[model samples]
Target: MSDLAKDAASMAKGSAGLRGAPHHTAKPLHDFKAASHDLSALGALGSLLKATGDIRDGMNTLSALTESLSEEWNAEAKLLGEVSDAFDLLDVLLSAAARAKKG
Candidate 1:
């Protein structure tokens, strides 16, 4: 198989693994002042923010990778576009969660 095909297959397998992973819901902090006094809640918020940044970074990397691929790779472009869309949706959801937690 071509290297591109191999890489795509590997990405697909990784995606499948993500699909089966357990979900985690962050506890919403309605009051920033109250949450600031709680060490555990602060820690959780920090973790959530860090995760959101990481996801954004991953999305950027994927976009760069897609841009570097040849124009003839239409199938790969379509696949990467779907992946990018998912990342965008996730980013929006995370942003909303962060905002809700702040309020």
Candidate 2:
């Protein structure tokens, strides 16, 4: 086997050892029911209000980021247009110079 394959196998075995052997144990039904009930209760009207606030904040952040990106794109586009114009001017100058030389 290749060194890479051997190394991978060794790493897998090491990780398996780290996840100690599994053991079976029974949990009380009341504990499980209470935990489930508490989790559901935790998402009350207050939780909904908090989620709404978080969503509004997220939308504001998204708007700001979008505006920033748009500004950058506009600036870059303007710069690219200028560079293209300069290239066109240079082309015209070069053509004139060539014609003059030929004549």
Candidate 3:
């Protein structure tokens, strides 16, 4: 009776159910074929192309902005030079007036 009980306990420990073994299906070939069809390389190339185009566009925009800023700076510098010349003329006139008043 103890020998039969040991056999029954061993069978129960090894089996998924009281009498049945575990069942598992194999991976289908079609699943492997689908997994092998990767487009990550093409996706990376596409992203690289888009980034290059964007960088080119940004460089163009920066060049235009730099040129515009240069023009604005030149205009401001010219205005400052004109104001300086006018101040010089005013100083000369004031000095002449002072000399005439002393005479």
Candidate 4:
């Protein structure tokens, strides 16, 4: 092909490529991206709230157990049980923080 013809063909190809791009036609990709980001934030927040609620419930259980054990003079057993409860709560808190940070 002649140089002029080659130039015209290349320009046509470039224009065709641009036409296929979503940005050139204002596709809904921008809105979808925003919605996806919002959903992710909501999910993270939900996870954190759930984890905190779980920890609070567990603490309440531990406190009640401790009070009962104290009346029976079972301090050693209560200490072990409370240690397990503490670890479980820590696990929830750390998992929640990690999931939130990932988002």
In terms of lDDT, model 4 sits at 0.51
Most accurate candidate by lDDT: 4
Worst 10 residues of 2 by lDDT: 18-27
Segments of candidate 4 deviating more than 4 angstroms: 23-103
**Residues 30-67, candidate 3, lDDT per residue (tens digit)?**
34333334434446664666664554465556555655
Q: Per-residue lDDT tens digits of candidate 1, residues 1-89?
A: 43444555666665544443322111222233233344453356657667645544655565445444423254554575566556656
Off by over 4 Å in 3: 1-49
Two-way TM-score contest, 1 vs 3, winner = 3
**Candidate that scores best on TM-score:** 2
Query: Candidate 2, 38: how far from true, in Å?
Result: 29
Instruction: Write down the TM-score of every candidate.
Output: 0.31, 0.52, 0.51, 0.29
lDDT of 4 at 44: 66
Question: Considering summed lDDT, which 10 consecutive residues are worst modelled in model 1?
Answer: 21-30
- Which digits, one per residue and each the tens of the lDDT, describe model 2 over residues 1-103? 4343444455445444433221111133334433433444436663766664555465556555655655565565555555545555666676788899999
Cα TM-score of candidate 4: 0.29
lDDT of each model, Cα atoms only?
A: 0.50, 0.50, 0.48, 0.51
Clashes of each: 0, 0, 0, 0
